[model samples]
Target: MSNPADLGVSSLVLQTAEGGDINPVYLGIFVVYLLLVLAIGAWAYLETDDVNDFWVYGKRLGPWLATWSYVANFVSAVSVIGFIGAVYGDGYSIMTGIIFGLMLGVSGLYFVVHKVRELNHVTFPDIIAELTGTEVARPIAGFVLLANAWVYLIMQLVGAGLLVTVITGVPYEYMIWVIGGVFILYTVLGGLVSVAWTDLVQGTLMVATVAVALVYITLDLGGIVTINQQFAALDSGYVAPLGDGTYTGLAVLASIVAFFGTIFTSQATIIRINATDSIRTAKIHLAAAGVILAVFYTMLIMLGAGTTVALTDAGLTVDNVDMAFPVLITEYVPTTIGTVIIVAILSGILSTTDTRLHACGVTTARDIYDYFTGGEASDEKLMRVSRLSTIGFGIAATAIAVNPPGTIIGLYEWRAVLLTSALLIPVYVALYSRDTPGKAVLLSIILGTAFGPGWEAFGAPFGAPPTFMGVGMALIGLTIGHLVLKGQKETPAETAVGND
Candidate 1:
């Protein structure tokens, strides 16, 4: 087997084959890419004149740009590194959570597109507040967005630092600041305009590179049949539907809920829909992104399966499976092509990081700060606050990434739980349940978010996922509140219905 250090040392970066010097090629590539995005940021700044322009490009994005932006932002390095590694370790079963769940979730977004565009709100928190008809709904949803996004931002910074360090032999400490500071700078400058436009390029790069890589690797391994034969030869479980129980029914189901909930409830996804130039654009772009992701994730799975055969034949072994994608590239891919693939992976990481970081700033400025300030802050003041919040949130996430305590993966898992459990029912009922009081929805959000974490903390008794338990608690809260406050104040939905 190949060495554990084949990829890189502490940073998992690769050095020159001789003299162990840093690879100038990789370093040069990193610098050029950074400069390009920074340039885009500067241009996006001109387009950003007010809070509307900054947050959602004044709701002017068309289908192609919107589709690519959502795809690029959502895919992230998880597809590049984690998903491949997941398939490598657990076989196709991991797809139930990571790939299929995301696919279904995005497609399912269509069901609510009409309601989302009808409201035509600014932020996800704005939707929550508008739906709930409560002054505090904005801040409550803001907290959810901030908590999830901030931790996710930290994870991206952590992952990027580690990835760059491994690829270039740069010090982990230095990479964190450079990567974090650069993205934050651009995020502050460009906002969503910068993010959406740059993602068009990034998303295309991702698809083209992966498409080429998947084809080449599959042919190299003598096609899919040969690859499957090799998998079964290594371990029958590898070819099994369940992959030797690597993922249980409960686990797979949990993943579906978490992933589904994320797309269903998160500010990040909702912002994409709300930012479209028209409701039709929202529908077309979301559906397009989902289709692209379907093809993209399928390629990743095939690549993962192919790597299994390639590594074995090359006598390569990865100490950590997450390194499988990079390992395969270094060992099997040609230098020029492999270099582009690596950069594309990094691009995936940055695309998502910038989007989430942008969400953080928007949430804080609009949902938190503006709400407290009587919602009359001048466009000038809101713009200023939005930029400042972007910087503040980005820097904070970076600082935590520097000295993160324990495993950060837990933070990623908690995101969907909080977003979906806490807000899913509330948002839906607010949209559809005409007779349900706004206070009932409010109670649902509070109870669901509250007990969602409580169930998680209590160890998810009987193996039930905490997210579902939180949903149950939320339903209970809704019922109780509906019974008590049912006639006190009509819901926003009810008021709309009454007017109709």
Candidate 2:
């Protein structure tokens, strides 16, 4: 089955007229850029000492690199393609939901970063086991983290393939293989070091490219004055913050919850936090990410809105609204710089993909294999397992991307709903509370995991978001279980030893 992007989401007829032609000079630049990425990975591998270095890079990331890593990981291709498409196709109001959601995520991170760093574990599940005093929490947190990561990695791969195809006219199938291989190579080789440094490069380019686009595009359209006048000439609903009848009250509310869930429960974000050097550094990273996202999203929203006005004024109709940004780049921007923008966008997606792939390795080694095997693996043995796991997971994600289940944004939302429902409260309770019994946690995990999908299958009663229902069910289960069981006190066990 063709993926959603191939089937309909990116099938803008104008793509042929506008994006079919490719410049050899631009392709050459992109190829050189990719080659540089691989070279960096090889250098990172040379510095790798053990499994710890591979997983968390010795927890030595300072503020700037950490900030770039966090920003790059947070702003993936899904955010660009999925979000821009939604804004273009619908109304500008979706931007509000995303912006607030991101801010909420940053806020949650502020509260947890210090504790997370102190725990000093490579994967989230290791931290969970520390606080919950139950070995089972490892697999529970690990499985959900891995599952959510896989779904998201696949979404990124799908987005990467689509973006490559639109820009270079390469066959999507071929592009998928190339993209997947490149991601696995960097992640499997150098681990977090490779992912982090490359992110520094990728994140800078990503933001610069977007900032340039916003300025260049705005100037080309005459000015902010001209852009606003153009917007004013269009349908009022199109320019409004609320979408054009597509995003209802319930849908907007659900998006808000979903965004919060994504940030709060995101393994990718948490893993980045664990990689930072200190609590102070982690907060700096979070604060910087918030600032970067504010600028990035503002520019992106304006670009999407401007694209809509420009395309409509030209009397062109796009079959798939997701092609809005691509069409704008192809038709308007100068060829050389446009090629650079394409690389920047491609880098944004790759940055996220590589992070998740590295995360899969860390979680698989620390949480799943080490926990089940009594935690006795040698560092050499552990490093071997982690690299192998990264490769294995990368292949699995590629297979799923072959026939993606939904649009980029939809798949992202589904993953967020599951993560929030299954893992959010458990994670929070584990990190911050001591009174909640491990038994209660286990039961809450089961119910919260079941409730979200169950509600989706039967009915989402009272128009409550799946995340809302799942979180509520978890809170209630945790409370009742605590009362009935009078939870067992945790045994003092220092598991954060080597992790630090």
Candidate 3:
């Protein structure tokens, strides 16, 4: 085990180590995890009866469980693959950006969670409609949320398909179809109940797996000091405060802005807060989730940095930087433990996919359908449409996953821009400021939406990233629109409506 030569593929092949073959162990752990997930789904289904139960667990979830579920939902394919890939490529600067960015997101909860809990809405679009006093806002918010959720879901499915192909030699196409189909079935069968419960379990396992892997990797590298020394020997930049020119000052600032703006407005994260039992619970959960996310992401960055040193020194080429963490685990850890890490990674992907799909379905039904139809739709009818929409969206995501349009990280960042621009201002005003006029709020959303896509198409000048530009335009529009509208004379009926 002390042999450095034993760490590479060539040496392992010569030793005829059982560690190389992951099929049986991977399949076994997956089966167990699947069974546990399905069982939880079934339990949740038995506990739920109405649409509220299906969508928000009847708003009865406790602090700890809700907190765990929220944290799990937030840490998606981005945490596992995107963050690790960034660390491997750019080093500690990426980690610094993420830590500060995440703290900004957590602070956003303080501004909005209590108000969101007060609304008592079952869906994100419902909150929008309530805030803006316009039916149109619901569908617009729904579209933005749907776009973000769909893109994120596809990213998770694609990651799962890739992981399966790498570990089991399955065709990527087949794995995509199989993984997507299973997720759709489980999600549609149990809805939010299934997603939440499964997330809780996956979240626990993932934390344990990452902690164990960190300890094991540290020991294998001859402890923390040796690991740091080795990293410095390779590239002192790895441990530096700022990245090695890979990410610029503007890019880092843009990242922080996007993180804060999106987390405050993103339907996926906000809806989790609304799903909790009470305002106190929501706040507690948000604080706890913040801490958990900070630790989990920091561990991932460290693992990525460590594995980069270990692999590079052994003359290995990490073609897919996203796989660096798993590759290191399998190469260095005992076979049984390695299997657990692989399953944990797969669990991360599946947890994210399941929650995203559920959000998409709920948004389509509640935000789009109920709004247009004047909330007259029967729960049965809406549920039927929701299930069908989930399948349709799942298929579309699978297609996109099969042929990704850009780097997964780029796709995610762009989606965040779109979401932040479109919904951030309106959502914040709705939660905190009662004076925000409905007309002004609607105008802000429209302007913000335009600004994001507009800046991207026009190539933002002043070296401003689209995320910053869009958010800036949104805030400006919001402030000016409200002032202009406030100066105008109000009709007697309009005055009455405002007072009400």
Candidate 4:
């Protein structure tokens, strides 16, 4: 039997055939990418002179730039490493997964963004505090946001380390330190202004790089028809309908709900929505981001399918799904071109890393420290704390990345479950229905978070998937809590204000 790695690598080699190890060239490209990012960061630092500038870019981002940055922020290490790996394992069902998630996300945004705008909040915790009118919600939401950001930051850091290790023949540990150090500096110094601008550049490069790779892979595999035939031959589950027995109608519905719910609740997603200058810009940017993400994820799914076919034809099976793109780039593309792809991967990883780090800092300072301390903290003090907290979290994430507990896909899934189950319901209520009682919101968050993770740890009564169990319980808990709280009486005047 051919080694899976050999099969994948051999196919890549066959495509390029440009002699010589291209690691040096790849390293050079990576240097250039890093330099470009640094330049953007430096420029942003010059433009930013206050805490608002640091945390929210003074809420001045326009539609196009904000839209691209939003898309880029949403598509991080997971889009390339985790999502593609998912397709490699699950086949065309992955495309359905992407579509279902995207559609719901877009719909959820329409409702959520308007509410977020009304609150005039900068971070996720700000929206939570506005809705609950309780200081507790701010700190809790901040902690959750910080945790989610840290988990995502680790993923991005790991992806960056992996790229550097692969390109420079360096140890993963060293690469982690190097990437972490650079990210901390840029993020602390430049803040959101730097992160957003860099994201714009990196996002464009990432899309272009993926497009080129997809085109090359499609042509190599004799186009879409042949690709579909190959997948069809692999498994009947590859192209089944949403209600098909493979994943079940209920599960599909739950997945869609979870996707929509998560995006609506997610601080990362909402922060981007809040970052836009106006409601009109937010709407336009949200729509544009949805379209861009749909296109990018669709192409990724196609690329994954194509890669699966190519590998199978060569008598290989991928064990490490995250390796799919890297294997292809190194083996199939010309050395010089392959180097560019590597740089693109690095760009994606760095853009995400910096954004998440900045988010962690700002969320911690604003949501936790400033909230509990009676909001008396000066911007300079908050900014200092934010920067320090960012460094602290970066260290923690680097530690986790150095000793990852599971596969990249598994880590991403766990992070998604954690963030979606606990925070999604509360976020949605806060954004859409102002009448949702503070007690209900708090209960929903506690129950959803507890049940979501609990169900994952202990098996469900039936043989339900963990994700379904978590999200289902979260929704049920939120509904019950909301209804229970809704029964409480209020004066006619109070009711009218709540209704609005």
* Best of the candidates, TM-score: 2
Across 1-500, the per-residue lDDT of candidate 4 in tens digits comes to: 11122223223222332323446766677667767777877787798899988887788889988987887787777777666666666666645544577567776677557767766778776767667655577777777677778878877876677656656655667667878987788788788888888888888888888888788878988998889888778875665653135666655665565556557666666667677788888888888888887788778788888877877776665456666666666655667667666756776677788888888888889889986677789989998998899889998998878755555555555566667777776667555677777666766677667776577567445766555666566667667877777756443322211110
Compute the lDDT of residue 148 as modeled in candidate 4.
Answer: 72
Clashes of each: 4, 1, 0, 3
RMSD of each: 4.3, 3.4, 6.0, 5.5
Clashing pairs for model 2 are: 93-241
Candidate 2 residue lDDT tens string, 262-321 = 787777777788888888998899988888888888887787767777777666655665
What is each predicted model's overall lDDT from 0 to 1? 0.77, 0.76, 0.73, 0.71
What does candidate 1's lDDT look like per residue over 202-238, in tens digits? 8898888888877887888899889888877887767
In angstroms, the error of model 3 at 232 is 2.8
- Estimate, for each residue in 269-323, the C-alpha lDDT of model 3 and write its tens digit: 7667778888999899988888888888778777777777777766666544555
Residue 7 lDDT, candidate 2, scale 0-100: 39
Give the winner by lDDT: 1 or 2. Answer: 1
**Regions of model 1 farther than 4 Å from truth:** 1-20, 405-410, 490-500
The parts of candidate 2 lying over 4 Å away from their true place are 1-23, 457-462, 490-500
List the candidates' TM-scores in order. Answer: 0.91, 0.92, 0.90, 0.88
Backbone clash pairs for candidate 1 read 11-166, 12-166, 13-166, 13-167
Displacement of residue 342 (Cα, Å) in model 3 is 1.4
Q: Between 2 and 4, whose lDDT is larger?
A: 2
Candidate 4 segments whose C-alpha is farther than 4 A from its true place: 1-22, 241-246, 315-317, 459-461, 465-500
Lowest summed-lDDT stretch of 10 residues in model 2? 1-10
Model 3 vs. true fold: TM: 0.90
